[model samples]
Each structure stands twice: as C-alpha cells, then as structure tokens.
Target: MRRPVTRRVLAALAATATGAAICVAVTTPQASAAVGSATGFATRNGGTTGGAGGQTVRATTGTQIHAALCNRASSSTPIIIQVEGTINHGNTTRVSGSSCNTAADVIELKQISNVTILGVGNGALFDQIGIHIREASNIIIQNVTVRNVKKSGSPISNGGDAIGMEANVRNVWVDHVTLEASGGESEGFDGLFDMKNNTQYVTLSYSILRNSGRGGLIGSSESDLSNDFVTFHHNLYENLDSRVPLLRGGTAHIYNNHYVNIRESGINSRAGGRAKVDNNYFRNSKDVLGTFYTNQAGYWQVSGNTFDNVTWSSRSSDNNPAGPNPTSNTSISIPYPYSLDAASCVPNIVSQTAGANKGIRTSNGSCATQNPTSGPTPGPTGNPTPTPSQPSGTNLSIGAGSDGSSKASGTSYGDVRDGNMSTAWSPSGATGQISIKWDTATRVSRINIREASGSVGNVRAWRVLNHDTGAVLATGSSAGVITFTATSLRKITFEITSSSGTPRVAEFETYAS
Candidate 1:
C-alpha cells in the first residue's frame, strides 16, 4: 500500500498524542552547487537552478505535474515544473508502467532527482495530496501551501505527510511555504515535514507551521542516527502540541524563530542530537529548548534564547531538562554563515516572511529568493502609516526596567526591551510588579507583553501605572497589544492584580505611535 518513505514516517509517530499519522501521500529543486560546498547541502540546493541546462515547463494540473516527473530523462536531466493552481489528488491519474498510481493516493517521485517543484501565480496548493521524495537528490520546493491531505487506512492510498523523505534523500531547500492539518491522527494528518534514514543537508526556512499536534521530527529511532547536517531558521511555529521539531542525532543549527503557544513542548532534542539553539523567541511553551523527555540524552548549546514562562522538569529517569538546572553543552560550528536577527525581531520577520504568497521577501543571509517563478510580486497595499505589524515608534523603555522584588542572572528586569525576546526578566511571583522608569519625562502610547508557557501564563488582571506621579496612565488585564493615548509621561509599570495563574511576562514592550 503506502510506500517505504510514507510507512517509515508514520511508524515514527503513530502513537504519541501529537504523533504523525499515515499520509494519504506526497512530496524539491536543484542547486547548482559543486559536489561539496561550504554553504551546507540544503542551502546550496533548490528550484531557481533546478531546471538549468534543461526544460522549464509550466503545469496547471495534478496530471501535468505527474507527467513532468514521469516523462523526465533519467534522474539528472534537471526539470523545473512550475505549478500554477491547486492540484487535488482526488482527481489524479495513473502513472504509466509504474505501480506509483496517483488516482489512489500521491504524486510519487520514487527515483527522481535534480528537479524543482515551484509554485507560481497567486499561489499554488497541493490540496488533499502529498508529495513523496525517496532515493532523490538535489531538489527545491518553494512558495507553496500543502494542506488538508487526509490519511487513509488503505496502505497504498495513505499518502502520509505534507512532505515526507527517507532513504538516501539529500540536498533540499523548502522555503516560504505553509504546511498543516486540522489535527493529529484522529484528523487523518501527519508530520508537516519529516526526514529519516541517512537523509541529510536540508534547510527549512521562512515557513509557517501551525495548528497541529506534531510539528516535525528527524530520525525514527535511537539507532537511526545517520540523519545529520540540517538547518531550520526564521520559521514560525505556532499552536502546536510538540516537536517544533524533535531532533534526533543530527547536527542542526536552529535560530531566529518565533515559537508561540506550543501547547505541549518545543525543540525536544534527544538521541545525542547536537543542536545550536540561538536567538529564538519561545513564548507560551514548555521546556522550549533542551534534551527533552527521553531516556537518551541529547546535548545543546543554547544562547540568546528568550524563554518566557517556560517550565523545567526534574532530572527523572526518562525526562531531562538539561540546564544549570540540567546539563551544559559546548557550542558547535554552523556550516553556513548566518546573520542573527535580534530575538525581538523574530516575530516581525517570521510573520512577514514565512508561509506561501509572501511577495519576494528578502532571503536569509546567502539564501536565494523564495518567491514563485512567476510574475513580479505586487507592491504594498492600502495602508502606509505605522501599524501594529510594523511599529514606527521608539521603545523608550529599552535597557530600563527592574524585576521590582525578584531577579536572577539571564532573567533580569532590564532584558524586557533589549531588542531580544529570547532573554526575559521573570519576577518572583505572579502577583509581583515589574516596572520601567525614565530619568527624563517620556511620552508613550503602546505596550505589548509576550507571556510565558503553561497554566501560569495569560495575564488577566494587570495595570500600567506612572511610577513618578503614582497616577494610572492605563490599566487593564490584557497583556498583548495594549494601546492608549500618547501621554506626556515619566514612568510606566505593569502590576499583576490577578491572572489566569502566575504571570510570566517574557516581554514588556512599549512604543510611541
């Protein structure tokens, strides 16, 4: 029924609450990289150069996409198939002379290599369809959304994930895309992205993953440790249960991501996975980064990470938090050169660049353009002034704040507006007060706070007070996106009168508009 890659992916997470389900079925570009390069394998591969020295064909239907792959001249011919509309698998056709029939399930690229699947126009979508890449190499997938691919019990038709890879898969770059399902197994969905069995040199950039029980995972077992040299950056992971993603044995470079409302956990590095966790904003999540709940202890070099209201577990038999409270790790070198966007800029950058339909957003470091291979991107729309998405005012409270009654190293009060959300100032208690005062009188209108994880999060009763005058400039229980009149002021403080529980305010941001 289902292929080797699909079955292997499903087998990895078919039991966990947020585990991946069987795919119904599905599935990159080519880089013109030399056999080996310093750019790292994943960054060096993708679509712009996929069809080079070959054909650049445009396909508007599922059958056309299948035809482009099936009719290719060997695995190295280099074909870039441009997809321009929603390709629904329900109406797919059979691939001639191959058991890889699409009418039943997925668009299989069993042995295809040197191909780039580029989505074009308003945006291309693979709806209720999946793409499988196995025994393939040198691929790129960009500017597309893969969603609602249902799972099937019929082994052949259960295409599996939004994207699945295994067995000698290599050198792929997936950028500016959205992959999701309504829920986990019960909803017939699987991993948004997955890799197994010697798969290596992959980069997932500027992508949006949301509303799923499981995000993604690397190896299938503690013994399957060959997966390595992967990079995940500037991706937005929101409303997930866990594994944004669960690393195992690979050497992964993770940075500048906005992880929001990870209902269960985030970045569960295990099985000796060496992760360089740097400059990420982890809000409303538990154990954001560390050797997580597993008997096999993974190592991490975590720095410049803003951990808001995140929880830490004890060093139990199978659950290790890996901290000063757990264990320390040495920093590893990332194969490619990358610029660290301040953790504070994570939300702004990820929200704007991630997911499909984003018009030609700037690439990350040396990474290439992720826009579709179609017409030029449309210009800005109606609004022109300062907006919430793009705050136009100065954060006067920068480097100015205290934990009021309690403070700790790396969690000091001054971390609030240091232009890094990865580091926060958590006070002593839920009912405590953390305030900001200016030596000189300053005017302000907007304030935003990113809460910590777990039940203690969700500030319910809070008040912003003028410290110098003891006058209330603005007061409310709301923590995120709080705005008031631009008033001539000297000081501001947030008092937690009541909350959903303890208020772990990770970021206390103020802006004048």
Candidate 2:
C-alpha cells in the first residue's frame, strides 16, 4: 500500500528541443559483486566502488535524478543512479547543476561522493520521498520502497528518515531497501536508517525495517560520541517499536538479524555502547536486549542467539534480560572479516539469504552438518542475564590522566585506563570538566563511571572532588559506580555541573573496596 507521488516535473519532457526524458548515461554493470546488478557496496571501504567502472544514469524523475546528480563530473567518479518512478517530493526543489540540496526533502546527497542509487525496472517507489545523506561518501541504496515522508516543518530528515545519514557520512551500504512508517513522531515518521554527526564505516545489509519506530541511529548526541564502525547483517526487523538500531557509543555488529513482531524495546545498548549480539533470530520480542529507555549503560557480546516466544524485563539499573542462553565476548573488532553463520541457522538462513531479490542465492545452513557430541541434549535452559560485565579496576587513570579538556580521539582518550569496555573517555562541551591526578598518594575507595555511548553526555548533578583537599568526594547525577572513602588521595575531580548530553567515560575506576 505505497504509491502516491508527483509534486512537479510533470510531463513527457523532452519538449523544447526534442524529447522530454533526457538523462541517460549507462556503462558500469559489468557485475562486480552481484545482487540486483550494478554492484554497489556489499563491501568496499569508504572511498566506495559503487557504480564500479563508473557512469550509468537512467532516471524517470526525482527531478531527473536531481539532474543526473547536477551533471556529475567529479566527487571522485563512480555513479549509477537507476531509479524508475514514484518520487513525490512536494516542494523544495534544487538540483540542476549538482550541489543537490532538495533540503526540505527528496533526493539531496549534499557533499556527494561515489554514488549508487538503484531501484530499476518495474517497481522503484519512493512515494513521499526522503533520501537525504548529507556529507556523503561511498553510498549504495538498493531495491527501494520508501513510504510516507511527511513533516515539512524542517527537522530536515530526522522528522522524515526513510534514509537520512548525516554529516561527514562515511562508507555506506544500504541494501534491498524497504522503509515504512505508520506512526511515531505523531505519525509523521522518523528513521528507517538514520545515522547522524560523524557517520562511520556503515553497512545495513539485506534491508527491510518494517512499520517503524526508528530502526536506525548510530550517534546523535548524548554529546554525540562519534559514531563507530557499524554493521547489521542479513536484516529484517519487522513490526518495530524501538531502536532495533539506536546505538550511540558505536562499535555495533548485530548479526544475522531477524526480529519479528518486536512491540517494545530491542537491542538498546546505551552510552558506553558496544554490541556483538551475533547469530540473532528473535520472535515475539519484548525486551530483546536491555539498558533501555536510558539509564546509560550499554554493552553486549552475546553469541549464537535464537529466542522464540520472548518476553523479558526484570533486572533494573541498566535494565537486563536479553533472551536465550547466550554470551559472546571480545568486545567488537569488525573492521572487516566475514563468515559466521549459526544461531541455529537463523530462520533458515534468514529465509534464504535476507533480501534484495536474492538472485545471488543464499543460505548454507547447518554449516554442512556433523554433530553428535555424545549424550545429553537439550535447549533453552536458564541463566538469562549477563551483558554488562567487563568493569573491574586497576585503572587509576591510564598514563596518569591529564586532559584539561577533550572531545577525544588519540584512540578516544586512552581507553579510560585500557581495561577496555571498548575504549572511551570522550569530553565534548556544553559545559565541560574532567580530571584525574596522581603523583603518589593512592589508595582510593571507589569511583567507577562506565557510561559512554551517547544519549546526551549523562552526568547531571556532578561533584566528586578532592583535587588536593578542598574536598567534595561524591555527588550525584550519574555515570555509575560511585563509592567514596578517599584516604591519601592526591587529586580527583569530575565537575560535570549538568548533563543529559555530551558525556563519555568508558571506565574511570579507582576502586579499593
């Protein structure tokens, strides 16, 4: 039930001089990686290889595909554009020579780069039209099916994310697309694949995020801890309700995806965000992985997951209850390195290789069987909690701590002390402060603050001083792990002042208890 577009560009245009349907360029389709053909981002870092050997324009009207990307010549070559119909933008037009800014909506790949927007032949819908992608990079959006993109009051794309991805956007890869919206944001809709600020090495494969309640987000404040290396494999999050993708601290790697009928909450790794929940396949879904609705606490490393009639939501203070009997670790390190198919062969290998007209044919399930392991066999036993583990302490402030100020990145502020939850110490501003000193006067009581994955810098009513003597010791507003007892302390200060934004501190441990 998606079709209704046309706000101008009416005609069989080829008028004036000859035919109205001009914009035809064709070339690259030598089939590099195969899927729907134009070989666009299945994988190929940030510079992009989409539109492979370059040149292929087609278009039916999204304003002639923004006038063939405003007559592309450079953005580093590579271009494929195919599209076929349904592009109703309803206004804000401007893409005749290239900066392609349809701002109020529809088609706008602002700082363009190697592009690839395919949706060829028969059905290529973009109905209420969204597709923004600001400071662009190597992009690729395949198969197409964007619906209801209203909200013209200008939140730009957030108010209508069918595919937004903002600023300095890096290596993108959205495939077999199909984003819908019926409610959320008062029915105007938001997010289907929304990534903000410093969007990074991206990948949203075999896509199909149904109905919508935001199935996307990497980093967009909580002091926006720079978005990290992302990846959500073999996608299909149906009938959504929560951020099947709302991650802030970044390092996501959610595998084999297929979460059906999720009515409330699922995969919400908070602040010091870190996900690796692999081999997934949830069913009736409830609290499919918690920390949820904010308490700022996110970390997951679960393995080979598979839940059925799921329903969990008990343990509080960083809510926990993600189903099945799983637990995987090693934090997150997927820069690129594939092969891992087993969560009991996720719903028959995601119903035979996820999406985008599988012509490349998928599924190898049962990993070529051969298992007996003698005796006792059973499934779904007990122990349901366990995700937020890694947090002990020896970290007396790595390399001795001294950053009068920091938004971080040298490896993101020394990993708090390198105990590593993933690595973080971020200190962006709005009203900043961060301190930790020691020349020799140790034996501290406790001061664990592991919250750095974004929602808005946490830290609210801060205090926790000792900075040599003008003592304050402990105060609230949260980041976690508080316990004061200071004895021969040299210095310690964490003057946040106030926050619901911009707070990252992977682990600032000082425990002696």
Candidate 3:
C-alpha cells in the first residue's frame, strides 16, 4: 500500500512566491559532449545526444530551465541545463522567445530540440509538477524525481503524468529518474511515463516507476497508432495496477527490467503491437504479460524471463493473460545492439542501479561481472541460425504461402505474392515485415522485390531473414535483386527496417537460378 502525499508544505511554498520572476542570469559555457551516450532505440535515428557541443547552464527553478531554452540562438541549438532544488507551479512560468515555445504551470520542452535537463547538487525534485515534451527531438531528462502529479486535483499539471512525451516527439532518452504517484486514476493520478502521437525512437532506462495506477503507455488508443520504436531496459516497476505499459501499436524491446507487485497487469501489448520481452524478472504480479481488456490481440516474443509467485487470470474475450506458461506468439527481430544479463540477476542488478541519485550505476549487462558504467556491447544477441547453401531452380514462391508481422489497413500479407503489380502489401507503419512460407522446407537464394508503382523508393534499408531459423540471410539498402547463401527453410521474411514512407511491396518473387 502507498501512503498519501503531504501537499500542505508545497502549497505553502507556492503561496509565498508572487507572480514576479526570479532573475538568474546564466552565460554560455564551452562546448562539450553529453554526460552519457544514449542506449537502445534512442541510439537510433541519428542518436540522442542532448545538449552536446553547445553550452551548459545551471538552473534552480523551472523558469530558469525555460529561460535557457528561450535564450538559445536557435530552437535546435544544443544546451545542457543542470537543475537543483524543487520545481512547482509557482516557480514555473511561460517564457516568450523566438527559439522556444513554453507554457506556465508545467516544465515544458515544446517545439525545441537538443536539450538535456540533469539534476545535480542536492538533487532536483518536481513535486506535484509534470514534465511535458511535445514536438521535441534529441532531448534527455535524467537523475530527477517527479511525484504526486494529478490531472483532477486543485493543482494539476501534464494531465497527471510524471513524464509525458507526445506529438511528433523523437529521439528522447529518459534515464536514471524516479517517477511515482501516490494513488490510482480514481485518486487523480495517471501514467508515470507515456508517449503518443507519432512519437518514435525513444528509450527509458535505469529508471524507477512505482505506486501509480498506470505505469505508462506507447500509443494513446487503438486508433492512435503512429508511435513506434521504443525501448525499456534495466528499470524497476513496482506496485502498479496496470499498463506497465499498455502498448497500442509499435515495436518495443523491453529487457533487463525488474517488475514487482504489479497488482492488476503488466506489459499489456494490444492492437497489433509487438514486444520483444527478454531477460526480465516478474515477481508477485498478476497477469504480468498479455492482451487484456480488448478482443483485438497484440503479440510478444519472450525469452530468458523469470516469474516468481506470479498469478494468471482465466482466459476470456476481454482478458487474455500470457501466464502459467507463457510462450511466444510472434517472433520480433530487433535491429539494434544489446546485451542481456541473466534473468536470475535482473532483480539484483536493477535494485542497485535503477532510479536517481544512485551514482548512475548500471549492470554491464553481464551477470558474471557488474561494472559501474553503462552501455551495451556491439552486435545483437539472439541472432538467427546460419544460412546454408541451396540448389538452383525456378520461382519457389509462386505457389507458396505468405504471412507478415503486420499489414496496412487496406492491404493483406498474401498480396505480396499475388503476382499482381497493382495490388500490394504495406506495413502498418513506415517499417515492419512481410514473409513467405511453405508447409515443407524449401530452398532459395534470390528474391526480386517489386515495389508498388507509387511507393517505389520508399524502402530505405532492409534485411532478408530465415524466419524458420531466425538467421540473417542477407541485408542491404533498397529492394531489388537480393541474393545470399541458399538456405532451406519453411519461412523467409523480408523485413523493411528503415523507410522514408510506408513501404509497399507488389511482388516478393523468390528464385533459385
């Protein structure tokens, strides 16, 4: 059970401060790199190195943080702000400037880019305040505590989210922070960490989210499906009711995290979303993984996870819990590099490393050895098996079967092999997968991928995978003639990893000649 927060102290502080501004002048410092490199999906999409190679400033109030953004020469100018002390609505105000768009009553990082807010000195606490990031990119928020935020209380901010990102947000790395609420949505608290509205390439690592009704979510609803490519690693989630993320639609890699006392549910992937959940420990939780509250299902690829004293709910149309003996419903191929600490060690590693003011310690992602620093090694784990050679022949896919990770609303997975150049298949997002399958093992080494007439050149990068063995048969940029060592398999997947637009494949022709 969580204790109620004492708001009287904070209310008195808010009352003492008048509407007058607290002037704190700051000078631009020498250029420097970010305090730490981003990991996971945040390392993708040109990487998130917030406030590097520009300037550094110190702030004691939320207003000063906004002033730093407003004072930048340009909205994209890189700047780091080290914050100390408490930030509430009273000390936060709207700052007008050409380079920034800010608002009162919340810590707003809106319509800006390349900024980092780091807590220092005695540590920064956003008491009853929320940090909102919207229409922003290349941002980092670290080593702070945000608590007791509410959407329906007398003093409200950020709709009760401790840290919320939305509206085309990109490349955000939120690490080493603590986000918590005293109670559930009925008590006026919402999600602790949330992203929506086309947000992409974000990572939340080495953090703690506890005692909240909702832990977080990727997309806002079943219809709001534009968000994708997020990662959650080495974090602690405890005493939460549900939505220990409610993933609506996206690719989320949740690894090396510790989940405890999840009262209702956890990792609720629904509405065609896919989650690669690996190397995690779930203890004393109920329905920790599954598609619940909806008939529309989601998917997950599970590996190396430990469940202790966890309970499962009975199967129903509105409650499908992946428990008792959870297994993979879909195979998710991760495009980034990562290392996994053994599942047995996740609880210990996360306890020592997750959250703010803990020396920013992290598990080296190796169970045998624990290092003080963070960052994953190069090369991806859980790679597919090696591809073997095959014999030359004609088009093997002409009469073969087809499937995919996802398909666009108007398209079908079978359309990739219908041999009709006009009818095509597209992913639900800008990037996803399409595959061809057979009842028996088949051999092939070549594939001619014909793009839809209007969608030609939409694919930027791709990989040919042996879906049967999860092996990387071939990788290249653009779709055309793809060749590799012939491999015999029941299924082969053509995965579009990067694209400028939603890719459409008219034909996925397979050959062996």
Q: Which candidate gets the maximum TM-score versus the true structure? A: 3
Predicted model with the maximum lDDT: 3
C-alpha lDDT of residue 244 in model 3:
82
Model 2, poorest ten-residue lDDT window?
378-387
Global lDDT of model 1: 0.64
> After aligning candidate 2 to the native by TM-score, how far in Å is the CA of 261 from where it should be?
15
Ranking by TM-score: 3, 1, 2
* Candidate no. 1 TM-score: 0.64
lDDT of 3 by residue, 1-513 (tens): 323322212111111125554445343443433345789999999999888756666778887888778878899989877788899988788877788888887899999999988876667899999999999999988888999999997699999999999999999999889899999999999999999999999999988898889999999989989999999999989789999889999999999998887989899999999999998988778999999999989999999999878999899998889988899999988888999998886765665567766545566767532333432111112222111123246667788999998888999888888778899999999889899998988888788777775454456568899998798987654465667777888999999998744588998888865
Greater-TM-score candidate between 2 and 3: 3
lDDT of each: 0.64, 0.62, 0.81
* Candidate achieving higher lDDT, 1 or 2: 1
User: Which digits, one per residue and each the tens of the lDDT, describe model 1 over residues 33-75?
Assistant: 1111223347643422344434445666666666556555555
**Is candidate 1 or 3 superior in TM-score?**
3
What TM-score does candidate 3 reach?
0.68
C-alpha root-mean-square deviation, each candidate? 12.9, 19.0, 21.2
Off by over 4 Å in 2: 1-48, 51-68, 73-93, 97-104, 108-138, 141-159, 162-183, 194-202, 205-212, 216-240, 243-303, 306-513
